[model samples]
Target: MNAGHPIPGPASVLAGARVMPVLTIPSATMAAPLAEALVAGGARCAEVTFRTPDAEQALEAMAAHGGLTVGAGTVLTPGQVERAVAAGARFVVSPGFDEQVVSRCAELGIPVIPGVATATELMRALRAGLDTVKLFPAEPLGGLSTLRALAAPFPGTRFIPTGGIRAAHLAAYLADPSVLAVGGTWLATPAHLERGDYEEIRRLTAEAVARSTS
Candidate 1:
């Protein structure tokens, strides 16, 4: 596999703080406005989930937004990976780590942050040469306690816990030195998106960022 491309430095810079707002929009057309709201709210990046029908288009819109560091989320296949990169995603994320997807991303040189839930999955990711990965459905998988436990043995690995995460867990997750960032849909809830309440989204994002940094 060819190292396709270098992971943008901004990704590491932003993740170092441990706050990445994940967005699952209804359509790709909503991507730009939503991204603007997130950035205004203080988040410099977003993970556009493939759950929506317009995932690829959304990724393109967010990437074109300029200031926001956009990534493709919920990625499950190598085809999606290829399309995502072509659509302008800066990185790739999956609910679980798939060797084919991971290796494909590795070859493409795109920084892939796959999901993990147990020691087994974590170890698999480690063997694949990944130092950063996501902890899916973060809360149900033991949340902070689980992360604390994993940290001791895999001190070199960093996690971005997502799934069932709320603002309440923000501090605990970010406080952990090994946590690269936490992903959740809290910042872009359905009600907020339906109303196109960019201001409110922006405010919440800023608050989340401030709280994390504090």
Candidate 2:
């Protein structure tokens, strides 16, 4: 992750966040309060996934809320990259690394953590000048051991593992130095957002943070 640029790298975007909440908003209304609650829990960063129609508006609200390192997730297209930045996203993430999407983001100067599942995809990321990446659906992809094996080859790279990760599973990932951070949808689930359970979300976030830091 390069640092001397105007936009921060994945390292900076992910810094101080042991577990980043992967959020999907049902509407624009839930953005601010959700960000505030996560901030209260000591995690200042959140990934607002572009999975719903209201995602862009929600990202706009969250980024404008201030104090949060707001990132756009599930971004799959170059056009979405444009929209994400337009909506105030400080960083962008994709399920898989695409040359077009990455190049577009580079043109815009926004840091992107593209998803890679194999050595082949990782080589592409390296060629694209990316030092950090996301290991999507990590649990299904063999979890910690798999990452360890992958890291053995690309020692300079850092990984953020996402998908199907539970609170009980945070320690194993964080214990590895190659893991920059863990991104989990379990931090603030659809149920929590739908029910407006900021308290539970905060509590869960706090618990995860406490454990990750300890």
Overall local distance difference test of candidate 2 = 0.88
Q: What is the lDDT of residue 106 in candidate 1?
A: 74
Per-residue error for 209 in candidate 1, Å, reads 0.8
> Against the true structure, what is every candidate's RMSD?
2.3, 2.5
Regions more than 4 Å wrong, model 1: 1-17
RMSD of 2: 2.5
Candidate number with greatest TM-score: 2
For 1-214, candidate 2 gives per-residue lDDT tens digits of 3233333368776666778889998989998889888888888788999999999999999999887889999999999999999999989999998988888888888899999999999998887888899998899999888889889999889899998889988999999999888998887887898999999889998998998899
State every prediction's TM-score relative to the real structure: 0.92, 0.94
Angstrom error at residue 176, model 1: 0.5
Error at 86, model 2, angstroms: 0.9
